[model samples]
Target: MIHDVAIVGAGMAGASLAAAIGPRARVLLLEAEDMPGRHATGRSAAFWSETYGGPAVQPLTTASGPALRDGGYLTPLGSLHVGRAEDDARIERLLADFAGSGVELSRVDPAAHIPGLRPEWVRGVREPSCAYIDVAALHADYLAAAKAAGAEIRTDAAVTGAGRRDGVWHLETRAGLFSARLLVDAAGAWADEVAKLAGVAPIGITPYRRTMVQLRTDPPAPEGLPHVVDIAGNFYFKPEAGGRLWLTPHDESPSAACDIAPEEWDVAVAIDRLEKVVDWRVEAVERRWAGLRSFAPDRAPVYGFDPKTPGFFWCAGQGGFGIQTAPAASAMAAALLLGEGGVPEGLDAERYGAGRFPAMR
Candidate 1:
């Protein structure tokens, strides 16, 4: 069947894109896995901090705040960053860099909030505007909206090849062949591979491995506990749905595209570091898993059409901020594909466009 847009990979990006494009365009959302969000989107820390990404990316985060808050996906959880005395300068610089970005933050004595944490651990800052996102709910909401908008979503439909024919895209999949006027590549880690299949130059998108472990705590549920992150980003822990806590060593090792597994060494490193920063004890590990976070060479998201390819659009390299930035980024992708006037109001697409990485070509 031929659609107006054939979206590859039904992760948060593709799902949200399908929703944003709506009934205005005939959209076909495809996923390779049996379920959607089986990759990076499913494995996120589920945070929505406005000051999370670089300066250029902050606008998208800011613009996405309303949807995240009003859509019933966000809950205030706050975020805290601890650094040793030696790391004071970097921590201060980070705070200064994000001064007026709307992330409410302040420097506090670490020992006061964290009983056993030493004074040295309090050298950094805290961001009160940070919140935990209901990732599953967010993705599900987008999927439901997309479906209601007349977008067709297909799972277990992997695109093996994509080519241009008569000014349209011919996508070959195990399920069947489909055609579309435009092709949207939201394949996450396989984004570069998808571009290659479509005769577009690979954008040097590299996927990095990140591991997380969920641990059972003694009691109290740690209800008001905020996400604690090392100033150096060595490790981070946030309270989970129940009394459990999700922890990670924040490893960003380069890896090939595949189902990522947790390395014992990485898990050990997280445990060792986490123990030093908190008074609580990790009784047992309930689960351990890993996922791939793909990035462009510049570490920012890539959203727009390929300069060389007429109808092929690129919406990849969201890195770890895919969940939080999905709303705005998807809107940006739809706007660019439809060639609409200047990205709804506050978003600056020029910064995140695929053309930003000329060196990658």
Candidate 2:
């Protein structure tokens, strides 16, 4: 049997796309793991920060806010961007850049936002619009909705090869052979590899490893602490349940496509940075994990049909904003894929298309 579209991953990107397009097309959601969201989606400590993805990505993320908020997938955690006095210019530029972007922003004393804030952290920018994302619930909901819409999801279906034959995408997967009219490269970190398997030119999408550690602090993190991020891009941390703090060094080490392990050095760096930022004492490192955030050469998510290869579509290179941008990204991708002209408002749909990458040609 032939499906209308075959999505190569079952993570947030693929799942969201499936959820959006499943009603309009027969979708086959494929995952190499025994279950969906075993990679980045499963490990995301995501927050819908309007400034997190920079200017190009903020549109999609901002556009997604309504759906995520309406679905009750977001909680008002707020965001604090802290920096040294010397970094005032950067902070001002940030405030200026997003002045009227619909993302509420204001300057506040670091001490007010973070308990026991360091003296050097003199500059602070508060974004009240940012909120923590319920990633697990969103992923599950997307998969469930997709399935309910008649999309077939097959776990452990790693595609070994793909080729176009007789106007159909023939795929050889571990589960079995499958055919579809269009193939979406949503394999996350393995997207470039999947493109190669389909005899299409690789788009140079690279996966970077990011580490997160859960710390049981001596004083126990405050329940009302906002998600704190360093303006210099050194670290970020937010309070978790059970008096734990989820922390990251904001390290983006280059890595290949695979199950990633957190390096001890990275964990140490996170602790070191946290120590300088706040007065919280780490009684124990309750847990630590790492995941890959893939990106294209331009660092924007690639969408739209491939210019070089027909029947091949791109929904990859989401980097770290995949979950936060899923709602609108999926809507935009589905509209483009379905030949519908109704793209989401305020989303610069052309910037994310595959045609922008001359390297892929």
Candidate 3:
């Protein structure tokens, strides 16, 4: 059977976009793993921060807030961007950057917000708009929405080959053969490979590994501990359940597309950074893991169709902000994929268009 759209990788991007496009078209979601979101989506820090992907991505995140809150998928969990006296200029610049971007940010005392903060870390900015996302529930809801719309979901379907013949995408997957009018490359880290298989030029989407370490600290983390990020981009930590802290060195190690393990050096760097940030003692390293964040050379999400490849859509390069921006991003992607109506007002679709890439241009 030929589907109107067949999305590669059933992660957040693909699933949410499928749900957005399902009602109007016959959609098929193809997953390589036994389940969807087994990678980045599942391993996400699970917080929605407007400042996360920089000013360029703030619009999308801000626009998604209302829907997430309405769906009851967002819980009130604020964020704190902290720094030392030397980082005052950078901290001020942060507020200046998003001055009129609709994101609510205010300066505050770091020590008052983050308990046990070292004296050196004196500056703080509160982004009250930030919150925790129920990732698992959000993903499940999108899948359910797509399913309810009659979109077919196929797991364990690793695509081996892909080609367009007579305007239909003929795909060879581990699960079986499939045909679709429009093929979407949402394979996360493997997006380029999927494009190549479909006879499209590679867009230089590089995959980078990020590490996360869960620590059981001497002073159990306070329940209200905000997601604390460093102004220097060194590290960030937030309180997890049971008085545990989830920390990351903010390391972005260039890596190949595959299941990744946390590098011991990264874990050590995280611990060292954490110790300097707070006075709490880390009693145990409860858990450590890593996930790949793929990005286009420009670091902006790539949406819309390929310039030279017909019936092929590019829906990868989300990096770490995919889930937070999913609600709006998927809607934007759906508008483009469908070729009619439903475009979110004020969003510059051309900025995220696939044609923006230098290679394509």
Predictions: Cα RMSD each: 1.6, 0.9, 0.9
| Candidate 1 C-alpha lDDT tens digits along 98-157 | 888766779987665554565457575888888899999999989999999999888999
lDDT agreement of model 1 with the native:
0.85
Q: After superposing candidate 1, which stretches have Cα over 4 Å from the reference?
A: 218-221
The global C-alpha lDDT for each of the candidates, from Candidate 1 onward, is 0.85, 0.92, 0.92
Q: Which 10 successive residues of model 3 have the least lDDT summed?
A: 340-349
Question: Which wins on lDDT, candidate 1 or candidate 2?
Answer: 2
Question: Candidate 2 — which pairs collide?
Answer: none
Give residue 89's error in model 2 in angstroms: 2.4
Per-model TM-score on C-alpha atoms: 0.96, 0.98, 0.98
Model 3 lDDT vs. the true structure? 0.92
lDDT of 2 by residue, 24-83 (tens): 999999999999999999999878898997877989989999999999999999989999
